[model samples]
Structure formats: C-alpha cells, structure tokens
Target: MENSIILNPEKITADLYPKKFGKAGKIWTVILIAVCAIGLFAYIRQLNKGLVVTNMRDYVSWGIYISNFVFFVAISLVGSLITAIFRLANVEWSTPLTRIAEIIAVSAIVFASIIIIVDMGRPERFMNLFIYGRLQSPIIWDVVVISTYFFISLLLLYLPLMPDLKILNQDPSKNSRFLNHLYRIGGSFWKGTKEQLKINNKAVTTLCIIIIPVAFCIHTVTSWLFATTYRPGWDSTNFGAYFVSGAFLVGAGGVITAMYVFRKAYHLDKYITDLHFEKMGRIVVMLALLYLYFNVNEYLVPAFKMKKPEEEHLKELFTGSFAPMFWFAILVGMIIPIFILIFKRGRRPLPMFIAGVMIMVGAWFKRYLIVTPTLLHPFLPMHDVPESYKHYFPSWEEWAIAAGSLAGALLIMTFFVRIYPIIPIHETINEKNEMAEKK
Candidate 1:
C-alpha cells in the first residue's frame, strides 16, 4: 500500500498568515511615505501657483502627468488579467498571485484617478463633469468606464479575500489585536458554511465574467481619449487595441515584479515557486510580442506613408529629438524582454525580475512618447508661440508629483500586505487538500 501525505492545515496557516513587518519593511514604508509627502508638497505649490509652475504650454498642453495617468490605467489591467481571467480559465498555478495582482490593480486605479485630477488646472471643477457632462464625449466614456471598472475590481478583490479574513479572525494569536478586530469586523458574518461559500464563489465568478469587458472598456475608452482627437499622432483606428495590448504587458510585468518582491520579503518560497515565474515569463513574452506587433502597425504604416501631418511627429520619435527615449522604450520594453524571457533559463526569479523592471521602466517612457511628441507636432504647426511652447520638459513640480503618485500606489499595496494575507490562506489549504487527495 502506498502512503499518502497530507499538508497540515495549521502549519499551512502558520506559514501563510500575515506577519509583522521587520526592520527593512519599516524602512521601506518610511521612504515611501516621505516621497508621498514631497509629492503632496509639490501639488500644493502647483495649486497655489497654477499651471504656470509647470512646463506645459499651448503647443504641448499635456505633459508627464497625462503620461503617468495612462501608465496607471495600463498597469491596473493586471487585476482583471491575473484574478478574473485566470480564475475563469481555471489556471491553478496563478492561485498564489491573485491577491498580489488585485492589490496592485486597486492601488493603480486609485492613483490613476488621483493623477488625472492632478493634471487638471482647476481640480475643483472635477465634479462639474458629473453635473454637466455629455455622453458623446470620449472623456465622459473614460470616466464612466473607469469608475465602473474600479468598483468591479474592488469587489473581485474583496469577495475572494473574505475566506482569508475568516481564517485570520479565527486565529487571533498570529495577529495583533487591532488586526484581529479589523478581520472580525470584515468577516464576522462569514461562517464558512456551504451556502456562504456557494454564494461567494458565485459572486466571484459573476465578477470575473463582468470585469473582462469592463477592463477592456476602461483601457479602450482611455485610448479613445486620444484617438478621438484630431491631433497628428492621435488619429488612428489602432489605438484601442494598441493601448489594450500595452496595458496587459505592463500589468503583467508589474505582477511579475511584485511576485518576486513578496516572495522574497515574506519568505514565500514554497508558495511562490520558480514554476510561477516560469509560467508568467511565457505570458510576458507573448504579450511583449503582441505589443511589438502593434508598435509596428502604429508607427511603420504611418512612417511608410509619411503623411504630412504625421511626418514630423514620426520623425521626432524615430530619428529626432525623442529618438533616444523612443528606442529605449522599444528595445527595453519589448525587444530585450522578449529575448530575455524567450529562453527557459531566463525565466528564473532573478532574471525575470530584471526583465519585469525593464518592461515597466520602458513602458513608462513609451507612454510619455505617446503623449508629448505628438502634442509638439500638431496639425496647425508652431507659429508666433513662445520658444517655450516649442519645447516641453516636466518641471520639478511635475516630476515630484509623479514620483509621489507612484510612491502612494506602492504605499497602498504595502499597507494592504501588512494587514491581510498577501496569499489567500483558506484557498491554499483547500488546494492542498485537493492535491493531497489526488495524489
């Protein structure tokens, strides 16, 4: 007779429970808070001085803030990709990564909203959009879809989190009294009965179904914000799919980066094994290739035509002022990552982490290229505008605020990990039990 081994539920709980942050975590948190503080200070200055403090001008109306907003929107797609899409597809290897992706999605979307407000000269007028907005506008579409996506993403995050909350509440000894109290408040009604699990599973499945289109809509509408415009580079039918593919790529890179960080920080080697990174590396390669194809479609076809309106803009990106950053984004974001992740040995944790960072950094520059260069090369051409209007560089204040927004997003994820099990404990136990029985 063969002996079957079963994972100890208590041991699993002990290994997976959220633990107090050590010295390094405390230092990291403090640094993020400090960056957020600096960003807030910069925002206040911008508020007091108005748009004059920044380098945005008539020709280059949109700047790094818009780029950051696009980046946030792009990265937020990961929640839908990892959590909802993976769940619906029944991909078991992704189980440990769902919450990490969810928190990143939630945090990214929250900052996306914030950074857009930071872009507006009159932040107070944001409510007027709701009071006096028109449905025909792509802006209105973006606002509606983003708000809808946020809520659905939140529910997807919370619904799956309840079971873990119940486990945390039941095991008060592992948590601080305050954390235990918060857990009970959140999960007190969750008795883990069959009916409750059934309803929860159903709700999660329903959200998975709903979030897919909503996720596509959110980024698609955002791409429309540019595509609907008559600007040189903005006029393209390909923007929707272009933006969506890039979003998935960046979002996946973000998840890969976080997977490595959390696995190291929390000593989750057993849970977040190299196999997960290997699988994600494959996904990233595919996404990067898809995005690269879109990049070709976006630029190559236009460059081939050299449309008078688009010629200067394309030149600026290809062999002109923006050439360095443009090539950096392409090579680092797509080509190099493709090469690195294409090989099996490169799928290991450290190499994958390096590739993930490359993808993210390159993606940010790619967004910048998408926004700024075209604005500088509008259809009307520069005439009688200030030399300052001919050029655009983010002011110190803009850089500070952008850095702060990124830091703030990181802070949200950091705090979430501190309070909740970054990996779902109850789900892991159930998976282990099933695996044991199968074995």
Candidate 2:
C-alpha cells in the first residue's frame, strides 16, 4: 500500500500542484502589498522625525523591532535544521517537507535582514558598518554572518528549485508569460544531464555542510549582543545554549503551523499526512523541554541568587508589570503544549495546530523577554527620558510593519507553492525507484 501510494503519484498532486494564484490569492497578495506600503511610509516618518517617533529612548532602545529581528533569524534556522539536515541524513520521509522548510528559511532570513536594518538607529549610516566595521564588535560579526547565512539559504532554496523550475517551465498553463520567460532564463541551462545532476547534488551537499556553521554563527552572535553586556539577565553564562534551543523550538513551531495551513488549503493530506504532524509534535515537545530546562537555568538561578542587579528585572517578570505576560508565555508556550503533545490524541492534526499556535505566540513573547526586559533593567536607572520611554509596547505602526513582514512571508510561501512543486516530485520519484530496485 505504501509503495502504491508512492509509485502512482496521487492525482492529489495534480490537483494540489502549485498553481498561479487565483482571485483569492491575488487579493491576498494585494492586501499584503498595501500593508507593507503603509509600514514603509511609517518608517519613513520615523526616519524623518528621528527615533523620537518610536518612543524608544536609550534605556529601551531595543524594542519590538529588535525582538522581531531575532524572531525572523530564529525561525530562519528551520531551513538548515529540517531541510538540509534531513536530506543529508538520507531521511526519505522528509522529502515532502524540504521545500516547506526551505521556503520558510528563505523568507524569514530575507526579512531578518530587513528588520534588523529597521531597528537601526541610523540606517543611513549602515554603510558605516561596512566602511568602518570592527571585527571586535558583535554587530560586525552579526552583519557578516547574517549576510552569509542569507546567501547560503537562498542558494539552498534556489539549487533544489532548479530541477523543479525545469519541471515548472514545461507547464505552459501554470505561469505567466513573464514567469515562463523568467524560468527559461533562470533554468534554461539546467537540462538535468546526469553530470549536471551529479554536480548539483554535490553542490547542495557542500552547502548543507557549510550552512550549519553559518547558521550557528548568526544566532550565537545574536545571543552575544546580550551576553556581552553587563546586564543581569543577559549576563548569563548559559545564554548561547538557551538562545539556540529556544530558536529551534520556535522555528519548529513555525514550520508545523505553516505545514497544517498549507496542507489543508492545498489539500495535500495525501503527502503531508497525520504521520508528519505526529512526528513533528514529538520534536516540538522535545525542543520545548530542552528550552524549558534552559529557561530554568536562565531565570531560576538568577531568581535564587537574587543578585542586586537581577532583583528588579526578576521582580518585574514575577510579580510586577510583566508578571501576567511572563506566566502566560510559560504556560501557553511550553508547559501546556508539552503535556498535550505527550498524549496520543494531542499529536493529531487539530490539537497539533493548537499547540503550534501556542508555541508561536509564546515565542514572540519569549523574544520580547530577551529584548525588552533587559532594556528595562539597564545597568543604570531609567531617567531623563520621557515616561513613555520607560515602558515598551509596539506602536500601531510597529505592529503594522511586523504584521506586514509576516504577511510578506506568507505571500512568498504562497506564491512559491503556486509556482513550484511543494513536495519534491523528482526526488520522491527517484526515491521510489531506488526502493523498487532494492526490492
């Protein structure tokens, strides 16, 4: 039965195949473009009026924008984790998921680059980082590493896409004249010759090897931005591990969420089955536990020590202004989902969707904790700034921009699914052939 399912490609593939966006898809695209335009306008306003428009003063300088940047980078790691790791490990079942993971990685990393620039106090001065970039500063490392990560991720996405684009180019019905021409130009050279295939495969493998270190560098540098500081919560000896684990957890949660939505919308249950969700639920649960362990180390030890600098920050999260958010993040993000996923029923699609949503929402707050709380507990007391600067809440403009970036990601994923085979048709067929030969 499994062989039959694999050998005879389901008609579902034809039905679910990447199609040009219909009216619904086009409308969705337009809405995202409009939202993004408004955000660009607001950003221009902020740039003209100075950072004063942001309500972020020196103490709370890193606000929603920076947190949003971290979220994008964290989620981008899904590409390296799921797609490259599984492919190189020769995990056959993962073929259906590689495109999804790769697209998410590419989209998130693209925006990770953008959002960090948005967070810059002097974006125009960004060239200064290049002109006068110092190896000594974590910021320079972040810029260098993130750019490398983005390119490798883009290559990882594009390399696999070559074969698929060749397939897509054959379908005169599914693309526009422009897209048809684009594919012709982009992939006309790819005839899928055995030599070409061998070379392409080797290149992907090499990139898979290289991206691991590049991915680690990007996130570790993000953590260093905090750990290098003298601030209490950010000063933790365990910051790097804590950041990496939580990053993966959130990233997996994102992939799971997107998987469920795309599976249903595209009617891909024949490919992305309950089995994938069940397996993903188990992975997410493990990551959550790992992150929870780090969370204990991150906060519990600090809470236990009650260090003079840590006191105010800990109080703020435990019983002060941030208490409700803190507990909600823990309960909704980690604890409840962990328990739910352990149950057989909970690993099913609907419950897993609920868990995915919880994890993603919690991850946002987790980034907030990583960002805002540290600023609130700056080495010096909050003074000489407007009272508004003392508190951190994303202005409507901020929310609009963040939401637009997310919408942009969805649009990219949506259009990608429309144009390319979301599940690798060629790879799936090859694997099935190999299995049949073995039999």
lDDT of each: 0.93, 0.83
Off by over 4 Å in 2: 1-16, 22-24
Prediction 1 global C-alpha lDDT: 0.93
Error of 2 at 168 (Å): 1.3
Candidate 1: Cα lDDT at 395: 94
lDDT of 1 by residue, 171-283 (tens): 68778888878988889788899999999999999999999999999999999999999998889999999999999999999999999999999998888888899999999
The candidate scoring highest on lDDT is 1
TM-score per candidate: 0.98, 0.95
| Candidate 2, residue 161: how far the Cα is off, in Å | 1.4
The sequence of per-residue lDDT tens digits that candidate 2 reaches over residues 1-439 is 3334654444533654576666777887898888878788878877887677775777788888888888888888888888777777877677778888888988898888888788786899889999999999999999998999989988988888787677767676667887788788878788899999999999999999998888878888899988998896899779888888888888888888888887877777777788888888989999999999999989998899998888999999999999999999998899999998989899988899889899989988888888898788877886577776678877776777777777777778877777677888667666667777787
